[model samples]
Target chain A: MTADAAVVVENAEKWFGLNPALANVSLRVHPGEFVALLGRNGAGKSTLLRVVARLVKPNRGRVRIWGVDVARDPERGRERIGLVAHQTYLYPGLTARENLRLHARLHRLEGAGERVAAALTEAGLNLSADRPVRGFSRGMQQRLAIARATLHGPELVLLDEPFTGLDLEAAELLSERLRQWAAAGRTIVMATHNLEQGLEGVTRWVLLDRGRIVTEWTGDSTAVRSRYRQFLKGAPPGAQGRRT
Target chain B: MKGLQKHLGLVALLAMMAALYAIFVLAPVELTMGVVQKIFYFHVSSAWVGFLAIYLVCFCSLRFLRNRDRQWDIRAAAAAEVGAVFLTLNLVSGPIWAKPVWGIWWTWDARLTTTFVLWLIYMGYLMLRRLVDSPEQRARLSAVVSIFGAVNALVVYMANRWWRTQHPQPVIAGGEDSGLHPDMLLALLVTVLAFTLLFFCLWKMGCDLERTRDSVESLRRTAQRHLREVR
Candidate 1:
């Protein structure tokens, strides 16, 4: 990892009271790198993504997103980041189109009307764009959320379980989009348990266990799939520790 | 924490003790209003501190909007909560002090009415915070509400002057001839100081508690989401 890396998390640590949520996690992702964070339920992959997205401040460490230090000036760094957490981050009261318009206004994007329209088309929600987001199916909301996250053309995209609730067709379409995004050189860090769907566009796989980076691998999908299956088979249940 | 803030709580405790002595003993009873006039010391001090708290809310909320820093948001939330508590004290004490002096339990005068509305605004601000689930969205919405509430605070402060109601005129800054008795003024200043110091102490503790709660909530939400993904 160098200064030119898209994301640089240096010796990151997060503690919840007496318990450690993340411990000495340092990762560096070059531009356009698609890194899949693979782990069991409480492995802290989501925490790592949140730290990188500047949603959660680390107890001890420095995070630089697109060369901007998150601690010192997280706002500047956030302009380059597109984060899709488990929550859709959409207002249920507003229609899908209105939601996109609000997002466009919040970001102050030029040509907001055209951008919102394009986002609706891209999310495959053109027919339902005028309907309230509360009425949309989970898959539709997720699609709209993905579009909204990318609306500002951010340089880095952080996805936490993006494949949740997606149909096979929608999942494949999102994977294809991820492949395109990686091809066009936009960094992505996706944390997902759907190993089969997540492996489609990943350039590398990083395994986390008990808040620490256990190992990482770069190989064919089938080889990584077998390795993931073997690792899960050996692990115990409800084992990762955090009290607060 | 570098300077005065490091010893704020201890200083506040000492000031509280000093204020009690001054309010109950040092200040002579008013011939016009009797011993119940003693409530004035605390009532006015609570209003002043309430103003300070709401003003801090506006200032920190603006900073949060500009910087998008969660610390600023937390500060604004803390100030809003503390402000609401003090405003509630102001509201309750006004009625208790009024029942004896004005010979009525309540009046819909400009000052009292505006002050009541201010308290209501704070309740709405707090309710909005609880209603929003997303942390960022909650911060943004609460910041906007706080900025608006500051306008009401200004109106509440000026209600006695602007509308000329049953509430007494401002004794501290009304004019050269409107000053309070020397001992009473001294007592008022001491109590205000004590209250201001205490506000900061509470605010600091509130911010610390909020930080802990935010971390725990964030972690818990992520864990629940992760579990759902697995399921």
Candidate 2:
């Protein structure tokens, strides 16, 4: 593991019973590298991101976050990671601000009140901070989830399908937040089916097909969508399956 | 390995049968309650096993929280299911025992009430798991509830000791003068041992069923994905 690498997944393989979700996948993410994982559904993009976040374990191999092996010391590994999964990971009964405070307490953040206040403002949820999250719109909930994930100021952030239910304006807000985090030297690995949207402003793009890295490209988002479409056309039928 | 499990299961069944014989034919009947006292052998044993199963749930829940492993969560859920089944048996049999002895099918005794509450809490725990869609969230929420339920178990166990009620004092731990006959104690011990073994067999079976269900679900997802790709 390199000292500068924020996340390292080496020869990782994970299986859900008979279905192989991740097969011999290895990747190293350095500090401030915004990696956009692009693939069709069931291409193992989410699984790979989950492995780096230590939310799921690999059947055979190791994942290291900032030079610390996750399997050996999961608590410490989790301390440095902030994950925004497909599920918002929020309590429906709690208000947006209350949910952030609970997350702050879990991460043992210092100056939790101030940090939560700032996170709410950053997510544009300050006005609705006291409203129960159950009453919030899907886009509002997604924004709150983003705020909750980044509340502890983690060094590495893993987002799985973060743009799934967002409107145009919410998407733009999230994009701005991602750019700001990247500028602050935080490593980000995002899995998204929105190829064109994901490629914008990302440092690198990796295409996964059937649990394997099929191709990689960096720089220029203008033609990336066409390249991704071409790659999908050439992939086997099973590799183009719907997401699990 | 499966053959070994089958053999062990058969052994447990045979041992249970032997315990029944010991309870009915070998052990002398109580002078006061006669045949109705027979239910005490299995009733007390099942209650012990039920409490043990819930404790196992608590232990597995704590482990799941510490490691965030799905295996631990599965174990905790299986234990809770088995625990709930045994607790149901205990509650039903208690009413059967109570109808003839106390002339009432139920009572608001401290011990009885607390045990019922404990059952409700765990049943709610299972319901909470069913309501949650995500596996991670379900595990986290259920773990917190299970820990609280385990703490409630302590209160249930001590209820009879703390308060006087219509419920009979504990036969095993009812102070110096309240000891059982040597022969009766031996019979109870054998029955308890049999029930503990039975609990383990049921728990293992439940765990196996859960694992198979998960595998089938995964396979179904894979098949669905394949069908979508072909379309």
Q: State which candidate has the highest TM-score.
A: 2
Candidate 1's error at B170, in angstroms?
Answer: 15
Give the TM-score of each candidate: 0.63, 0.71
Candidate 1, A25: how far from true, in Å?
A: 5.6
Which tens-of-lDDT digit does each residue in B44-136 have in candidate 1?
Answer: 999888878888999999998776677888899998899889988999898898888778878766667777888888899999999997677
> What TM-score quantifies how close candidate 1 is to the native fold?
0.63
Model 2 chain A is weakest, by summed lDDT over 10 consecutive residues, at A235-244
Question: What lDDT tens digits, residue by residue, belong to model 1 across residues A1-244?
Answer: 3568999999998764334669999999999889999998779999999998788877789999867898999878888888876678999999999998988888889999999999899888999999999998878888888888889999999999888878777677778878878888899999988877756668899999878998999976889998889888653335333212
Give the per-residue lDDT digits (tens) of candidate 2, residues A1-244.
2667888888999763355778899898888899989888988998898787677777788998889999899999999988877689999999998999999998999999999999888788889999999999988998898888888889998888987877887788788888788888888999998764545568888988889887789877767778777776653544643443
Pairs of residues at least 3 apart in sequence or in different chains that clash in candidate 2 = none
